[model samples]
Target: MRIKALALAATSALLLTACSDSPSDTDIQAALQPRLEGASCVTAAMFKSFPVTLGSTFSTGVSSGNAPAFDALTDAGLLAKSDKTYSLTDPGRAAYVEQASGFCYSQGYEIAKIKDISPNTGPMGAAVDKSWIVTVDIRQKPIAAWAKTPAIEKLARNPENLSDVPKTYHVTVGRVKGEQGLKLIDPRFSIMRGVSVSQGY
Candidate 1:
């Protein structure tokens, strides 16, 4: 009788352990999908807005060096150049972000793979607030229409000009266990423009 009781107890413990195992990759990926899909990556500085003087030459380090890009924007109907000065068209204004001070080219991203998930432990080795550091590979979705322009693609190809071009980025994501199961916390990821020594040159 005693042996049977011990066996039953052990079986129950094993069941509980299995039930309490960390969430699977599918679950983690599902949690990340919505966040990734909703996010947009933009050029770091190529589309940044600058003060324009109507009828005067739109002269700036950025404009002077990347005249082709400016011309492309003009061709795309996003900019209007009159008397050598450039101004944003209605569409350009719509794409502009005041906070970023740049035109937005919304690009989608996805979780390529979940590399690792390790417990976030405190100094004493106890799990910190039941959190884990999830390492993942993030890759861009299909290229957006605006970014597919030949000039834009050329700009992106130049590593010095557009650092934020679509590419696989390895990042650490934060995950915490809550009442509702595993919840992703900080997943700060974005493509940004590369800083050029001579503006767009």
Candidate 2:
């Protein structure tokens, strides 16, 4: 019914730092497209439990019970399970924590930071019969202007009616099993439909 976060553009400064190469503007937008489409879905998956099997394999992790968030790590032997407890095979709790902080959805949104992830019956479960809710800090342009697309200024958050910049928006990601998936639920854009800085910030 309304244009959501994924409907817009994103590639917060955090994503740029992920690589040493400087991606073209097109590359950045292309990278963020999937995230815009399923922002909510992955957001939901990101918070869901990393499957009991996966959870017990790592002291910390985040992902949909349905989605294999750490299949690569598992293959790498970075994680293992002994009984019901999950432990990192690598040394140092700090290293484990650092690895755990990293996550990415099927879409392109990178999990910059995870404040908390809890298991729950969420919209994503409507079709899969299982799902998990996650609260995460999604890194996106502080304002649409940063993306060089000012048309959706309404969808971007601007505090104090000031300049655009990089910002971290806390969001809840989930799904209800429809045509599109993972619609982001953000309070900031509730009124974006009818308001814009051009209209007079």
Candidate 3:
């Protein structure tokens, strides 16, 4: 009778362990998809600065360097040009981020695929509280209409020859077990490079 009781207890423990297993890749991906999809993607240039001088000369000549892009934006009704100087319209101001010194063009990113999932280990090489590092391929969604113009698209493309803008970005996401079961945690979406214009510009 003692032996039978021990066996039953062991079986119950095994069942409990199995039930508390970490979420699978599929489950993690499903939870992470919406989060990634809601993250906005911006451009490296275009609206490189905010609060454009209302009366300053925004030379559209070759000397301006970004004349084509500026003209495209002006035509898109984002910029109001009086003679040569440029100022942000209501719509433009709505898109502008003075702190970022640029505008968000693309709506968000989409999960292309889950690349890998590995146990997040501590310095001692032991798993850290049921945590994992999830790597995924994410693609930027379609950009705003104002940003689709050739000049604007050209300005946004990292490599001039690259047909797609931010086609696939390899991002690392964190997942950990919580009281509410497994939950997706901090995702390093800032790994995306060339997505910000220089403050000097």
RMSD of each: 6.3, 24.5, 7.1
Against the true structure, candidate 2 reaches a TM-score of: 0.24
lDDT score at residue 152, model 1, on the 0-100 scale: 54
Local accuracy of candidate 3 as per-residue lDDT tens digits, 11-55: 999977755564566677665666655424344344556434332
| Off by more than 4 A, model 2 | 1-110, 121-126, 142-157, 160-195, 199-201
Task: Give every collision pair in model 3.
Answer: none
Residue 187 lDDT, candidate 1, scale 0-100: 44
- TM-score per model over all chains: 0.51, 0.24, 0.51
Pairs clashing in candidate 2?
Answer: 6-36, 40-182, 41-182, 44-173, 47-134, 56-86, 123-175
Task: List candidate 3 stretches off by more than 4 Å.
Answer: 1-22, 25-69, 112-124, 127-135, 157-190, 198-201
| lDDT on C-alpha atoms for all candidate structures | 0.55, 0.33, 0.54
Superposed Cα deviation of residue 52, candidate 1 (Å): 2.8
lDDT-sorted candidate list, best first = 1, 3, 2
Q: Is candidate 1 or candidate 2 better by TM-score?
A: 1
Question: Given candidate 1, what's the lDDT at residue 176?
Answer: 39
